[model samples]
Target chain A: MSAVLTKDIVKTFADVNAVDGISLAVPDGEFMVLLGPSGCGKTTFLRIICGLERQTTGDILIGGTVVNDIPPRARGVAMMFQSYGLYPHYKIRDNIAFPLRTQRVARAEIENKVEWASNLLGIGHLLDRRPRQLSGGERQRVALARALVREPTVLLLDEPLSNLDAKLRASARNEIKQFQQRVGTTTIYVTHDQVEAMGMGDRIAVIDHGRVRQVGTPTAIYDDPADRFVATFVGTPPMNLVAWNGGHLGFRPENFLPRELIDDSAVTEFSFRVDRSEYLGSERIVYGVLEGLESVQEITAKLPPAHVDQESIRPGEWHAFAVRNSALCYFDKDGKRAIRH
Target chain B: MPRPLAAAIREVSFYSAVLFFVVIAAFPFYWMVITAFKTNSDLYTLTNIPFWFNEAPTLAHIKYLFTQTLFARWLLNSLIIGVCVVAITLVTALPAGYSLARMTGRSGETLGIGIFMTYLVPPTLLFLPLSRVISMLGLQDSMWSLVLVYPTFTIPFCTWLLMGFFKAVPREIEEAAVVDGCSILGAFIKMVLPVSVPAILTVVIFTFTLTLQEFVYALTFISSSAQKTITLGVATDLVRGDIYFWGELMAGALIAAIPVAIAYNLFLDRFIAGITGGAVK
Candidate 1:
């Protein structure tokens, strides 16, 4: 097992800094995800690690050897690109065999490895087909077969599942995670999809605007985000954040419920109107402005769809909601996580 | 009139117009081919009907073309020059275009547009100084002079064409190849170049034709009969002063057109795609 490490990588294009100083370490066999929105510099960080783009200042190490001056081909890492990057003119077998051929591996060994990889990817039957002939999912597997055949110490995937349909993306995510675990290779995956990151990463690094906001296990980051950005960025319906107590108070919508539903153990309570409601089969989200500060703030509370008549939660009514103090996350002046238990 | 009659009349008139234009377009080529095979005696006769094959077709004009003049030598000179131009243009343009497309960013685009502007600089204006440069190289009568000079125009256009083509290939593919153990140059040869066949063929055909038929420089710098290209030699050597040897001239012209026509037919799909796709993409 080979660990991958980056020490303070930074990249700038023209006057705009793309990847701010970022230092990360992926333990041997760990699957780490650099999660961020587009233009947030996650891809730039991955490119820097691969030596495809020179960092303005940094040190990169794979398998304990410094690789700052190494070219991408010699860096001992393979990346599956967002585009799948199969050679359009070559068949799947040749695409998978390319890296080995470049390394001057003997023809017989190259064929063996190509076969092994295609089998591992469940794409052995598609070897004779060109990339343009394969469906998106098959093309994706071919790309993975190409990447894995090299068996580099570290594997980098840049939004590899982004092009798949939603259902296929979920399955591909599972495939990638299981594959990484089985191979036990240090893998760094980059994606803007929070769900994919949380589902596949052994640890997720939340990044925004070229900086890493927080890095931790998915559960830890979800339960205890390191900053306001992470709290809002990691969860679906994103943690509902609002101006409060001279800082920012945040609570997941699920934690905000009808006043009667919250017990005496609730730490904070508010009177807000439910002007809009969305029933999501399993639950209902009631949205409205906070009472008295109606013009200044709004809040949404999620409840079981059975709790109230659908019409009662409709627009033009006021309702009260409360939050369990434990579920609240507070960020200070600069949006850094500062809540204390 | 019944609707069927009206429709028939409209269809007939439309096809007639199409046939009229088609004949107008094809007549010269038809005339040239027949003239190439006609004897000088048959060609000069005033009483013979011109449209159909009335005389026994002879290869006399073509035979004279090969034997009486340096037409063979000129054709050979053109072939050599065309090959050199294609080689130099591809070697220089593919890498220059890739670098401009991948490395230079906004500056590369500006520089590329600037280089294309140099190609837009008419060769008629540059021939005088280029002639001086050729003479300075001690290549006053050398066909190598044309080989060296043709790229001055060929490279800029080829580079522009290739830059459009290379840029059209998504950068991720190249990056993936790099990650899969290829150096920048290795990726270019193994991946980028192979997928770029249409554009490469376009560059080859474009430069080859341009170099073969280019006359001003060939006429000005190359005075040696042996060094003149087919286009220059046939027009100058085949005619004595003012009289045109229609049979021989048409034969030479037809021969010159054959290779280009065959080349276009061979890569017709790629040629059209390269023209429309690379430029727009």
Candidate 2:
């Protein structure tokens, strides 16, 4: 059975649907990431799943049991907040032990579980110190340990790495992913950063404006986005859309390389004008408009640095660029993906 | 002027301003201390230097305050009222403030403002109706009347103060606790209240000191000398028409002020920022 499942959850705040009907199932031991931009209801959806927030309509099930009327503590879920939310006054030991103590677990077993959790997170030495005394990364580990101490049925994390520095975020991401895998706990992670979602998620649920736009494996979500929003929202220098046959033709920047780089027999060609070029060490991004669609739309082509020397593409000049026939993504006027006509 | 000399002049003027304010603020305490210790003869003599004692200092006034009057009973009454009122204020205000702080939209702000507005109605105006209520409760001339009436002011202001504080306490902490096997009230008591020690201390000291020094309501509600609070007793019982017992009055004021001073010093270090640090960004 799926460890956690929501059936058409809708949470309305002040007549505004903060979490509009979102139904998702997180299978046992799967890392499901809810990915979106800020204020996109991803966190709200996670909160609903955790029982921190009640859906205005619909039922929540944990381990196949309906938990609509159950409180957060009884729902067998644990959450790590965006801020890490370690109890500021408690020592790390007590913070990790708090959940078990609340459940009135046996004293010796609480100690053993606390030790197991601290050991799992490798925070055994910092047990006596308080939360404020720890660094940001340490605090994140402590929060993770506290969430994992009880061995919950589902683990919900809401942007838990956002408070760390850029350098720390990468390693913290690795730590949490590896830690989650080691424990094999069903996890639902929320984040706006595509890098984290793509790198760590077993499956990514792309959400926007209180609705899930797409739910697929990261590779599928990136390579075969279900809609224009997912296609445009997931990649850096996002997918370029130009007016095509009264609809939109979408192609990733990396796929729209110079014609010289295309080895495929089937290709669609465009006369690309390079207005600006940025050489970002590993790749070159060329920004320009296509010949016929110049005034209406701008397109981008990301070329691998090895394939194109920086001196080759000059600004304010025209060059031939093509996307393989297989790489083109057609979308209807409503931003839904459509098969090529 | 040369740069060094200009800097020197600025430095001198800054210290001079600081010294000026310090002396102005401390002058009353200095006067109280000296008068409390001065002998009756030195105080009554016109030629004696007012700032310092001409005769040997004595504890005679403090002795008189304790033995010759209901000063000890007044102290006990003030302590009881302060404790009771602080308890009531915390019990009422903490939950009220936490809920108000967490309440969504403009309603929390509106309700908080409504509660604080009651605090702005001065006790001078409030005492008339309050006195009627005190009499109706049959608590007139009892220190319990002051205890009952004090939270009417304290809870409102403290609730407003604590609402601002609890609002600053990140909602995520309490939410985390709730998810980690706690009820909403448990989260508040475990997660919210621990980090809010500084704010709670501020409320305790504010309520206690306000109760200790309050006179108007104490006077209106409790007419008996034995039931008078420290402030009311010090002022009224130490005065006989135009003849004021200045020594006993100063002694009483000095003694009543000590606990608040100690409380401030005791909790001032806790009014720090790092309590919630490392928990959030």
Candidate 3:
């Protein structure tokens, strides 16, 4: 059975459709991410599945049972908020034990569960401390412990790492994924950061303007974006898109290289002026205007530093770059990817 | 050398002004205590001998107030009314405020504003109409009238204050509680209320003090001498027709003011915090 299935979920606020009739099924033990920008209704969708919000017209099934009308407590799901909502008045131990206490578990069982969750999160020593007394990372761990202590059927995390600093966000993302894997819980994470969605999710659902644009494994979405929005939103320095007569050509900066690396018969070669080059340690990014094209159109190519260094390339100079035909992506005028021979 | 001299002069002038203001405000209270102990002749003379106590200080007025008058009974009546008003204000205002904070959309916002507007309407206008209502209810000339009327003013203001307090709680904290198996009401009681103690204390102190010192409604609604509160009882009975019992009156005012002053001082930090916490985002 599917761990969770949301069928034709529709939520409307006044005249605006916040979630416009979407559907998806999350397999058990898979980490699925709803990736979108703010105001895209990804968080609203997560809330609806968690039962914190009600869908205007839809059905939700969790663990093979319909839970459309179930209250949040009876939904058998736990949510971790982005703000790390630790109860300020309670010590960490009590905060983690809140879910068990609410279920009226025996006192000894509550203590044991709280202790086990705390120790797993490496917060055993901080159990006696209040949330205000702990650091940002520590408070996040407490929130995670609280959510995990219940051992719910599904775990919902809403932008849980957005509040952390950049350095901490990377480490926290890895730790959260590792923890989810160890617990083997079916997880649904919502985030606006596509990098986070790509790095953490087993499959990503790209949403925009309250509709799902594409849903696929990270590699599929990266290499074969269904539309222009997914192409531009998924990658860093995103895919370079240029208008063609009847279609569009899409390629990544790294795919473009010095002409010598390409087999002459199997490559498409283009000449461009080297406007500038940025040394990014492992590779150099070359930015230039395509030769014989409109001045407004600029192309970026990522090449190994040795090639650019050997050629003595500098700004305001011209160079020839090429790519294998297999590496190029074609999108029709409607922004949907078109098959290329 | 010139700058140093100018700075020193500025510092001295500032200190002098502060001292002058403190003395000016405190002199009347000081004179009241001095006169309360003086013989009736000393009071009539109105001498400017401010620093010295009466030549033959006596407690005759204090003795008279306790023994011959219903001063003690009136004091008891005021305490009972104040405590009851405080309790009622808290019970009604806390939940109303939480609802406004949590449930406010456009309509709730309009209703909250409307409730606050009622609070801002001057009490002078309200008391006249309220007296008729009080009499119709057969509460006039009784402590019950004051108890009922006090909450009308106090409840609106306290609810407004607590709405701000409740809004300051992060929504995520409450949502976390809900996910932890708490019902909405359970989350409020278990999570929201405990963090809001400082704001609640401010509301309690403010409602109690305002009810204790209110004069117009109490004086207008309650006509019977037997049922008078401390404010009306002290102001009316202590002073006779064309003869102000200056010493006895001052003594009575000072005695009545002590409890509220002490309460304010004890919860001063919370009062400041609650009032200002709403001003921040």
Candidate 4:
């Protein structure tokens, strides 16, 4: 296994810069996830790293070799396409063995590895079946088996779990994570699903509009977002942002506690007008517009479901909530993080 | 009329209409087969005699076709030319179609349309100048003349046909193959071509039929009896200044139609799939 590194990569399609100058360094055996919304160039970045797409200007070094000019096969990168591009014509065994066959591995060794991978993914009995005969989860396992069977320097997955159903997506996500750890193969997975990124990556790179907006551990991205976009995009119920004293203040929904929880007057407080509230089993999520703000902006506040007194709060009513100063993240007018003295 | 009887009557009329069309379509094929089996007196009764046949069903016409004439040689020439045309069309069109389907630039559709337009130009218009070029190369009066001339039509049409089929294949499958250590050409061979079996079969049948049935170029370029294809031989050699060899000619026509009919029936489903492109998905 080797660390994959990109130096100032830029990909321009005619006049549109699909991937702006972005540099990334994925350590050996690390699970690096590129996360973004659709058309955000996360897939493009992953494709460049796999050599399926060429960068207009950059160097991709896989295992310390500049692989910018090398083809994908020579680069020793095996990618599992988002659709689990299992060859429809090939049996499961052959699909998993394709990369090894291309590498000209001996027949005995190829069979041994194919068997090992199929069994590892709990799909050994499916070896004789065509991809069309298998379910989506089975196809995903076959795709993963094919990618890892060759034992490449890097494994690339493009939204691999997105095809599975919701129930399967969670389990498959964990399986992929555990599989990557077991093999200790350096993997770069691309997904538009933040929960996948949050749950799967050793570190996540949040991408937007052909640029890396933030790269950090999942907890850091959740707790200390670099800017307003990351603050709002990375959290569930999303982070609430409002203009306060000429600065944009960002706070997580969970960080907005009932007024009794905060004893300090120095903390930021909001008279949140409750527009609606949802009772999730663990948390009571209250969504509303903050009172006394000239410009209209909505906010969400999370409370313990045990403490959700149904008689005390209702829709179109104002509620007292306070945000601890430490919990407040400030961003400048341009949405860049602001450090207050 | 009562409702049930009226419904039955409608069904009967519908079947009769279908039967009428079927008879109109099938009568000529029946006439060819019956003529091939008829004795000399049976054919002389008249060309228009309805349900015509004689008491005797003779194999004499078939015997004359195989023994008395160079019909076998003409059949072999046609077979050789048809196979060569298919091979050449495949060699040129598969790659050209792949390139057209996978082309990244804006001109891909334009170039594809331009190539298809060449197929629309009448072969009758081309044979005039093509025969001169054929004789210039000293390939005149040989089956090679037709072999060389046929792909000029086949390649363009096959390329256009296969382009649509190749485009129907998902780009991700090829990209996946590329990442699995296949070169672009390797991806096309191992993945694209195998997935395109139906379209390839369609192209084979089309090129086979075209070269076999093409009469103008074959007759115009090759005047020697030894070099004549089946179509040219049946139409020209069997008619000696309007003295038609009715039985032998029909026998030759019947034999030629058999292989094409069998091939179509064998690949009818696949041919439909190739045109519709819904087999795999």
Judging by DockQ, tell me the better candidate of 1 and 3: 3
Whole-model lDDT, model 1: 0.87
In the range A245-278, model 4's lDDT, one tens digit per residue, is 6768888888897788777887877788888888
lDDT, model 4, position A242:
84
Which regions of candidate 3 deviate over 4 angstroms? A292-298, B56-58
Q: Which 10-residue window in model 1 chain B sums to the lowest lDDT?
A: B272-281
TM-score of chain A of each: 0.95, 0.98, 0.95, 0.96
**Per-model DockQ:** 0.81, 0.80, 0.87, 0.83
Off by over 4 Å in 4: A263-266, A294-297, B1-10, B46-49, B278-281
The candidate that wins on lDDT is 2
Least lDDT summed over 10 consecutive residues: which range in candidate 3 chain B?
B45-54
Instruction: For model 2, name the residue pairs that clash.
Output: none
- Candidate with best TM-score: 4
- Cα lDDT tens digits, model 3, B87-166, are 99999999999999888666766787789999988889998889889989998789989899999999999898888888
Model 1 TM-score on chain A: 0.95
User: What lDDT tens digits, residue by residue, belong to model 1 across residues A1-341?
Assistant: 34888888889898788988898888888999999989999998999998888999878888899999999999889988998888998888999999998899999999999999988889999989899999999999998888889798888899999899999988988998899888887899999998988899999998898988888999999999998888888877778777766678788888887778876674688777777888889988777777644222357777788876686566887766788898888888688888562
In order, what fnat does every candidate score? Answer: 0.84, 0.87, 0.84, 0.84
Per residue, candidate 2 scores C-alpha lDDT tens digits across B157-210 of 889888888888888888878888888889989888888888888888889989
lDDT (10s digit) by residue, model 3, range A1-341: 78999899999999899999889999999999999989999999999999888999999999999999899999999999999888999998899999999999999999999989999999999988999999888888988999999899999999999888999999999999999999999999999998899999999999998889999999999988998889888877677766665667777778887787666568877786788888898888888877765421367788778656835667887777777778788888788888862
Spell out the clash pairs found in candidate 1: none
Chain B vs. true chain B: TM-score per candidate: 0.93, 0.95, 0.93, 0.95
Worst 10 residues of 1 chain A by lDDT: A291-300
Docking level of model 3: high
